[model samples]
Target: MSFDLHGRTQRLELSDQNLRAFEAVVLESTPEGIVLSKSAFYPGGGGQPADHGVLLWQGVETRIVGVRKGDDLHLIPAEGDPIPPVGTVVEAAVADERRSALMRTHSGLHVLCGVVFRDYGSLVTGGNMEPFSARMDFNLPEVPPGFKEAVEDACNAEITADRRIDVRVLPRSEAFAIPDIIRTATNLVPDDVEDVRVVDIVGLDTQADGGTHVASTKQIGRIKVAKIESKGRGFRRLRITISD
Candidate 1:
């Protein structure tokens, strides 16, 4: 299959890394697997989870159980298969169900960020995501007594609004012009990259990001502010759970 550089536009397409195997002509050989002209697989970056699945080549199914990045390229398993010379094609498929769940969880966190920033002006300090749950750290002296409920209400309101989630790659200059772009946690964006992919929650939130997400907030379902913990010194942690 031809590789699409613009995979974020179609979340379903983005999940195909484990579903469809393609003939990947090797571009460069390494102890690791070869690089192809187009790869559905993601080389894992940001705080998002890595893409895990399988790689098939020359009738051998090598488990691509992990993904790592090197100089902007992905290092996958070569197993025992003879590395095809440059110009060879390989098939790749992504673990769809796992990826989809991550998409939901990632988008849910963005919604939460919007609610927290809009309501309390808190800044996100750090966060991570699993298939069904996510946690975000914020720099707040103390969560208001009713902050949890308020955040829940706001998130659901945005979900109910069915806001569209737009993903786009922008030139560095253009991206810096947007107000929300400046609010992202520093480590979330790679400073060396000249272009940045931005995720925009229409009328809700926006930030520079590389993680995959659902097309609309409505797809995130009902989100629960499961727990809040004191992180001390003007910081708090918020845990969120989403029902399948």
Candidate 2:
């Protein structure tokens, strides 16, 4: 399997430490670990967290401590073991718990965006995600009183609804047809990119994205809109946390 440019959504099902033995073609080999033709790893981008996993070569396991994207390539950690030649097969596994936490956090941010956009017609200006927390900036004059609570409640309601999260790639023209998608705070779809990957939260949210997420809102567990702050004129920040 070639490396998927479009991100994956099944976090828990991802093999964590066991993918070291699978076959993979080395696309690029450097002092850093090689980039394989097909990798389950995601190089961090668009404010989302980077993937941490293990790459197996022979009987040796090397930790993938960091991932950086180059022009059409991903730069991984340096190999401490013998470097595999190009076309060599290797196994890759993502850190399961970290990936799962990020999935929940990423999905929770989407839910928050959906609620804020629907209720206030606000657009998200920026955002960042960690393992268990994330924050989004919105182009709103000010966060309304009790807005945080309202958003939390709205997110929980959707999670309880167990809405399915769908991800797929679409042609640029096809993706641009949706008004709601075009109105996202960030221009997630790169202009140079030919195809756009979209994440749809059933009837609640839809936007162009290339981040990992859960298959259903119910997998997000309990979400708390922990804080809301004013960034500047017409911009508000919402901080969120997901708990057990």
lDDT of 1 by residue, 1-244 (tens): 1123432212233434223344455566565644555555655555567766665566755556555565435446646644445555657677787777877888999999988988888888888888889899998887677889989999999999999999887887898888867554454565666777788999989888777888899998889999998888988899999775
Candidate 2's residue-wise lDDT over 20-138, tens digit each?
23456667777664666666665676678777877777787767777766544453665565566666677777788887788888889898888888989998888899998999889
Off by over 4 Å in 1: 1-23, 28-34, 78-88, 185-191
lDDT of 2: 0.75
Instruction: Kindly give the stretch of ten consecutive residues in candidate 1 with the minimal lDDT sum.
Output: 1-10
lDDT at 32 for candidate 1? 69
Report how far off residue 224 is in candidate 2 (Å). 0.4
- Measured by lDDT, the strongest candidate is 2
Give the lDDT of residue 201 in candidate 2: 95
TM-score of 2: 0.87
Q: Estimate each model's TM-score.
A: 0.83, 0.87
- Candidate 1 to native Cα RMSD, angstroms: 4.5
